[model samples]
Target: MTTQKKVSRQVTLELEAGNAAMVDIGKMLGPTGVNTRQLKLDYDEATAPQRGEIVPVVVTVFEDRSYALRYKTPPTAHLIRKAVGLEKGAGRPGSQTVAKLSREQLREIAERKLPDLNTDDVEAAMRQIAGTARSMGVLVAD
Candidate 1:
C-alpha cells in the first residue's frame, strides 16, 4: 500500500473561476517551492464549469513539493448578487434596500452552501444565509 506524503504547508486563496492569473498563483506558491505552473493549469481545468464565479481553494503542499487542491463554492454574497441580478450590494445596507429574494430562492442557495456551512440543518443554513442577505441590503420575502 502507498502511504500519503507528509504535508509541508497549506495555503488558501480566492480566485476567479477558470481564469486565475498565473502571476497570482506564482506569487502565492512560489515561496513554498510548489510548481505554480502546474497548479494554475490544474486549477483552471477543474474550475472551467464555474467560469464566472469566485472559487476558494485550499492547497496542501507535500514535503516533496507535490500538492493537492480542495475547492469550495463561491461566496454567499456573490451567489446572492447573482440571484438578484445585481452587480454589487447596497451602499448603505440597512438604510438602502437594493433587491428582494424569495424564500424558495433562499432555500436553494442554502442547499448549495450546505457543504461549506457549519450547520447540517437546512433551516439553520437558511437562517445563516438570510443574515448575510440582510447585511447586503437584500430583503428575504415570505
Candidate 2:
C-alpha cells in the first residue's frame, strides 16, 4: 500500500532589525510582487512589541522559486465588528485593540452561514464555527 502524506511545509525568515536590511532583501523578492516597502512596514509592526526581539517571518515558497511572505497586522476594529455583527465599536480596546464576539453573535452567524454542519442547534454550531474562523484569520466584520 502506498501512503500519501501532506506535501508542503512552512518556512520562516528571522530578521534582527525592523527594516534596516530589507532593501537588500527586496532586490531578491521584487520580481515576485513582494513589495519591499510593505515588507519593511510589516516588519516594523511585528517588532513593535518587543522593540528588540528577533522578528520571525513565516513565508510560503511555491515550487516556482517565488515566495509569499506572511507578515501582517491583526484585523482592524471595523473588521472584527462586522464579523461580530456590530455596526460600530464595542468596549474600548487597548493600544492594539481586538474586537470580540459574544456567544449570541457567534451562534447567529454559524447558524446562518455554515451549510455542512449537521447539527440543528445554533449556539453549539456557532461556537464551533467561531473556532474555525479564528484559526483561518478571517475577519467577517471587516
Candidate 3:
C-alpha cells in the first residue's frame, strides 16, 4: 500500500460576498494557477447571506492546485457598525464618539455573536462585545 502526502498553504482574504472576481482571486493565489471558477462559485454560495459585507475567507491550497475555502464570521467592529447604522467605525477610537448603543442592544449583539465568540457564557460574551464597542467609539449606555 502507498500513501500520498499533500502539501498545502493557507491564505486569508477579506472578500466581498457573492462578488469575488477573477482578478481578486488571482492576486491572492499569486501564480499558483488554482481553479478560480470553482472557487468563485463556492465562495459566492457560502457568502450569499453576507452580500455587500466584507467577510474573511481562508483558502487552503494544495500542491496539485486544488483548494478549499473556509469562511469566518465578520469582526466585532463590523457587526457594531451594522448595529449602530454607521458606515464605518470612528477615525479616532479614543477621544471621539461615533455612535451609541444601549445595554439591551449590546446584549443582543453579543447573543448573535455567541457562536463565534471564545466564551461560553452570554455575560462574558457581552463584556467582550462592550469592549469592541468602546474601541469603535460606540458608547454602550442606558
Candidate 4:
C-alpha cells in the first residue's frame, strides 16, 4: 500500500501571549476549517511567558486540521526595555537619552539574544543590539 503524505501550510502571526482570538485565527484557517479552538489553546500554551509581550509565531496547519506551533524571540526593542528596566523609549531619541547600559550588560544581552540575532559572533550581535538601544535613546558605554 502507498503511504499518503499530509501537506502542511504555514501562517505567521504576532500574537499576544494568552490572548488570541478566533477571528484572527479563523482568517488563517480559511472558510473550510473548524479547528480554531484547538489552535488558540496551542498558541496560549506555547507563549506562557506571563508578560503579554507580542511574539512572532509560525503555525503549521496540516491537512487533517491539526497544527504545529513555533514561537520566535521577542523583538530587540522589547528586550532592550526589559534589560534597561524602562516602560518606554524616549520620544525625542536624538536629543534625549532615557537609559544607559555598560559593555558587560550589553554583552549579556547579546549572549541572551544570540539565538535570534543574525550574526556569527557575540561582538557583532552586541553591535546590532547597541544600534537598537541607540535608536531607543539608550546610551551604551564602554
Candidate 5:
C-alpha cells in the first residue's frame, strides 16, 4: 500500500512561557489532531531567549498529510520593532530617531506585528527592531 497527504491549514498558534510544561499538546491542536510535539519544540527553541513572547511559526503539511512545523521570529524581525512603535524597514534609534513615526510607517509595522517582546537589552532589541524595518521595505543608510 502507498500513503500520501497534504497540509490543509496554517495557524498563528498562541504559546506562553510555560507552554512546554503542559502535557496536552493535542488539545491545542484543535479537531484536526495535528501533532504539536514537533511544533512545540520548534517554537520553544526559536523563542527560548525570549520565552514569554508569542513567536511566529510556520506549520507545513507533510506528504502523508500529517503535518510539519517550523518557527520563525515574526518572519521579519518584528518583536522589537513593534515595541518602539516604528515603521517596518524603518530607522534606528541612535542615527536620528523619533518616538512617534509617520502614519504609514505605523500601519506597516502594525500589519507585521510580533506577538509580544519581553526583553531588557536595548541593543539586541534594536537589532530585532531593525529587522522588522528591513522586512517592511525600509533601507538603512549604513
Candidate 6:
C-alpha cells in the first residue's frame, strides 16, 4: 500500500484564468520544490473556460514535491466591475458614485459567490456583496 505524502505547505496565487505561465508558477513554487511546469499545464487546462476572469488557486505542496490545486471562484470585485462594464472601481469611492447595480444583479452575484462566502443564506451573501459594491462606489438599486 502507498503511504500519503505529508503536506509541506500551501501557496495561494491569483492568476488570470487559463493564462498561467510556467515562469510565474516557477517563481512562486520553485523554492517549495514543486514541479511548476506540470502545475501550469493542469491549471491552464482546468481554467480554460474562464479565460478573462481572475481565478484564485491554492496549491498544497507535499513532502515528496508533489502538489494539489484547489480552484476558487473569481473575486467579488472583478464580478462587480464586469457587471458594471468598468475597467476599475472609483478612486474616491466614498465621495463618488461610479455605477449602480440592481437587486437582481446583486442576487446573481451572490449566488455565484455563495460557495466562497462565509454564510449559506443567499440573503446574507447578497448583503455582503452589496457592501462590497458600495465600497467600490457602486450603488445598489431597489
Q: For each candidate, what TM-score against the reference?
A: 0.94, 0.32, 0.84, 0.75, 0.39, 0.94
Ranking by TM-score: 6, 1, 3, 4, 5, 2
After superposition of all CA atoms, the RMSD between model 5 and the true structure is 10.9
- Higher-lDDT candidate of 2 and 3: 3
Error of 4 at 65 (Å): 3.6
lDDT of each residue in 10-109, candidate 1, tens digit only:
9998999999988888888898899898999899999999999999999999999999999998899999999999999989999999999999999999
Q: For candidate 4, lDDT tens digit of each residue in 26-113?
A: 8877653748888788788867764467677887777876667788877788878987899999999978999998898899878877
What lDDT score goes with residue 11 in model 6? 88
Clashes of 5: 8
Which window of 10 residues has the lowest lDDT sum in candidate 3? 3-12
Best by TM-score: 6
Deviation in angstroms for 78 in model 4? 0.7
Worst 10 residues of 2 by lDDT: 71-80
- Cα-based lDDT at residue 73, candidate 1: 83
Clashes of 2: 3
RMSD of 6: 1.3
**What is candidate 4's TM-score against the reference?**
0.75
lDDT of 2: 0.52
Would you give me the overall lDDT of model 5? 0.51
Better of 3 and 4 by lDDT: 3
Would you list the C-alpha lDDT of every candidate in the order shown? 0.94, 0.52, 0.85, 0.81, 0.51, 0.92
| Candidate 6 structure quality by residue, lDDT tens digits, 1-142 | 9988899989889888999867778888999988788899899999999999999999999999899999998999999999989898889998999999999999999999999999999999999999999999999999
Residue-level lDDT for 39 in candidate 1: 93
